[model samples]
Target chain A: MEPLINVAPYTGWVYPNETIFEWSVLIAVYPYLTGLVAGAFTVSSLYQVFGFERLKPVAHLALLTSLCFMFFVPLPLLLHLGHPERAFNATITPHWSSAMAMFGYFASFYVALLLLETWFAYRPFIVEKAQQRKDLLGTFYRILTLGSYDVSDKALRYDQKWILWLAIAGIPGAHGLHGYVGFVFGSIKAREWWSSDLMPVIFLFSAIISGVSLLAVIFVVSSKLRKIPIDLACLKGLAYTIWGFIMVALVLEGLEFANIVYKGREGVEMIMEYVTGPLLVPYFILQFAIGAILPFLWLSYMIWRGTTGRALIAGVTTCACLVLFSVFMMRWNVVIGGQEISKTGKGLLSYQMTLFGKEGALMAAALIIAPFLVLVVLTRLFPPWEDHAKSSSSLRSHA
Target chain B: MKKVSNPSLAARRSFLSKLARAAACTGALAGAGALGVGVAKGASAKTEAKPAAEGGSFPTKDYDWTKHQWAFGVDATKCIGCLRCVEACKVENDVPRNAHQFRTWVERYVYLEGEDRARIDSQQDPVNIAASGSEKEYRFANRYKDQKVDKAFFVPKLCNQCTHPACVQVCPVGATYKTEDGVVLIDHDYCIGCRYCVQACPYGARYFNEEHGVSDKCTWCYHRITKGMQPACVEACPVGARIFGDIKDKQSPVSLFIRNNRVQVLRPETGNAPNVFYVGIDKEVN
Candidate 1:
């Protein structure tokens, strides 16, 4: 069937298929979603294994966020597949040499690790809820206990030890998860924008920035929703980490661009034309200017004063949102922008994202939102923050 | 006396022994069954080979694929921009009518004197020479009317069927693969339609077949070639511009042409080692 929209003609020649990018915006969102998962998991590890006490407030929240995002990571991929049902063929008969063949293995292993870590970390709370509530919700918690009723101090110690080890193991797993995503694009030697040794590193650091910023926003928003005082120390520490990572990511990206320009290969002229033409808004304005530079400046000012207040919270929250937006735009520019340039080094193609199609922007938005909904459901089942609330209450009573 | 007293225990022991014996028998039967199937398959293969040796028609199931290395060649100088090859390929392959779904297409490269790069364009259908009176008359009336033309010619584009195909390497499932005979083909049933192969192809020769819901490309007319027929495009070329043959056969026209003429492949810098060779291809043709 013919495409509903007519493609605009440009000077020179393009392969017919070059006029229509097979990988859509849905493909772009796949990496962005996985980046969120990887970034959040890394943040959770800082408190769990590294002894960052100031980060304790959001540690559990971060793990939950990662798990929630992990659930939706493959949805965009499934939607983008021409035969979504045949996707299992990739796992069953995976060609080992292909970078993409590793995805099924990597995603499964990472998700499994995330689930086990989250379960072990929250086991004590589940046992407590199971005993305290005598209704269906209590029964649900009891079933979640997996028939293990042990909540002794010794058992709790074992849980902590295992959680620590899992967090340590997850560090590499998280890196592999997102690094593999970058390799999918980077290993394609055909496209200049993606074919860089720095692609994986850039993806990893950008993921950390996105993940931390997301946690910061969630922390602030959740605090307001629950009518609790914001944890200013935790917020300050997160802002500092975000600032450092953003700088490194920006520098790495800048070096890649500079290297490409310096080399000035045959494809460079066409790529330069692409960057200056259609990609101007997303690459320059959204990604670099608003996404990185503005957030970095605002975060730097916040970190410099060592301040913690309502205004500071509001400001950092805004910066976090911007950073998240920037990281997403970076993915868009890489995935879609790379495809915009025809391989012939003669012409450019335009992408008009369909709104109502199977693999459209609306579907991508739904995939992103589905994870947060899972987080909400998981909050009810596991109650990530309940144990901390209980301890604070007990101390209040004693005092 | 002790054995008689523990009657229930003795009965349980007897039942366990019986179960083990049954399992052993089942295992032996299954192994014999598998061996018998293997022998039958071997016998059938021998029978199929006997018929082929006696000069019977080549059956699809029994055809040995290892004998030939397929290759394609094009003489760009001979091409008159008549797109009969393109139309024949489309009809033969059942390629969709959409311009984007071409299995093969013709590109016209126009390089004016002093221009560093050539200006190129292509149409879904070839310029109709029959409808117009003559080549000179058609050129004067339709194309190059106002502009100064230094050198212009048609280059037919199809899958190069690279030996070290990036598409084959990037296919997560082994859906797209190179055959022993050097024909690159896709298994429609196996393809998950990830489009990785489409992106990995440097020549932009692969496309997602929207109708079939899988990645598709020129297979060098695998069905026709395997049955000892010229590819539709090669058969349709009026000027012998397109040639397809077994490169392994030193006497084949394609091999003779390559041996005699200065031949070049597209995007040699990519290191894909394409089997498609071109003669008289201008550097301006990418």
Candidate 2:
């Protein structure tokens, strides 16, 4: 069949085939989705393993968010594959030398760690809910209990110890999840925009920023919806962490760009053309200016002024939303931007995201929305805020 | 009762072992049979040609892949922007007729003396050159009629068949690989269509075959070459521009050409170690 769209007009010279990019917006979303998963899991680790008491309010929330996003991480990948049914070949008959072959293993291990830790953290609650109900929901909770009704102090202590160990192990597993995504692009020596030793590092930090920012937004919105007083201290703590990581991510990105320009690589001119011309708005305006710098400055001002109550919440929420947009734009810039320059270094190519095609924006939006829909179901079944409510009620009864 | 001989169990075990052995034997025979067919086909194609005295037969029997590494060379000076080779490749390889798909294509580079870069345009199918018009005429129509031309030439591009192919290294399922004969090939059934190899290829030689649902590229006409026939592109080159032969054969014209000419490969800085060599390659060619 003829291409529904002709090749976008290109300047100078490009191989005829180079006019179209094989990897598209779906690929861009793949890394972004995984980054959210990695970042959320890391935030949970900060509370579970690092003994950070202030992060307690959002610990379970963060873990739930991670699980929700992790479940949908492979959707974009499958959609991007030309033969989605054959994707499992990469697992069963994997080529070890290929970095991409490691994806299945890495994702499996990380997801397993996430599931196990989430179950252990919520086992007591599941057991309590199982005994509290006598209907089909009770049966479901009983199954979730896995036939062990031990909510004894010893069992709980053991669960805590195990949760800690898993969280410790999960930190690297989380890093590997998103780091591998970055490595996929970083290892491609052909594309100067992606070929950086710092790509993985930048991916990890930005992932944390996006994750923390997402948590901050979810916490505020969920609290407002539930009519619970917002946790200002928790919001501040998360904002501080998000601010720190964004700075690091921005610096690393800057250094990577500086190094490339200083080295004056063969493809630098073409990349410069891409950055200055076609990609100016997304790369400069959305990603660096509004996404990184604006949020960083806003959060810094909020922290310095020691703002509290409504103003602190507004500041943190706005920054979180902005950073979230920035990270998404960053992914778009990296994946799609890298493809804009021709491999020949003498031309540029263009991509227009189709609204209805398989790899189109609509599909990407659906994939993004799928996790949040799952999050709603998960939140209903295993409400992350339930434990906090129970603990507070017990303390009031004791008083 | 417990000590009674288990004759039925023993019989079943022996039957299973026999079946396993039979399966192994069948597998080995099938592999050998496939290889034998390839060798027979190559030999028979040669036998069908006229005798060597008539200068029509290629020495297919003398060139065993285990001992001979095949290579290709292109003389840019001899190329005249005639896209017969491009048409021949598509027909031979069953490449799609769409403009985006090409197994082999030619680029015309026009360098204005003082400019650091050349003006280049690649025509997807040279068979339609008349419809598209000649490069000179197109340039003239673009108001470059009075522009000074330092040098102009055509460079035909295909899969470099790199010794250290990035595509091979990046394939998640080992679907795309290099054969011992130095031809890079894709196992269409095994390819998951991840397009990672397509991205890894520095020369932009690989493309996703929408019809086949797999990554596709020029295989140097592996099937035809193994059957002792010239690649369609090489055979269709009216000016003898493209040269294809086993480089291990010291007396082969391609080997002699490589020995005599200061040939170059495209994008040597990529360190792909491309087996396709070019003569009179301009600096402007990527």
Q: For this target, which candidate reaches the highest DockQ against the unseen true structure?
A: 2
What DockQ would candidate 1 receive versus the native complex?
0.29
- Highest lDDT, which number? 2
Candidate 1 C-alpha error for residue A249, in Å: 0.4
Return the TM-score for chain B, candidate 2. 0.72
Alpha carbon lDDT of residue B3, candidate 2?
15
Minimum summed lDDT over a 10-residue window in model 1 chain A is located at A390-399
| Model 1: docking quality category | acceptable
Residue pairs clashing in model 2 are B83-B126
lDDT of 2 at A156: 72
Mark the 10 consecutive residues where model 2 chain B has the least summed lDDT: B1-10
Residue lDDT tens for model 1, B192-254 = 999999999998899887766788889888878877889999998999999889988999989
lDDT tens digits by residue: candidate 1, A114-204: 9899888777677778889999999988988898878666677777778888999999999888998999999997787888898999999
lDDT by residue (A298-395, candidate 2, tens digit) is 98898889989999999899999999999999899898888778888888878877888788889999988898889989989888894444632121
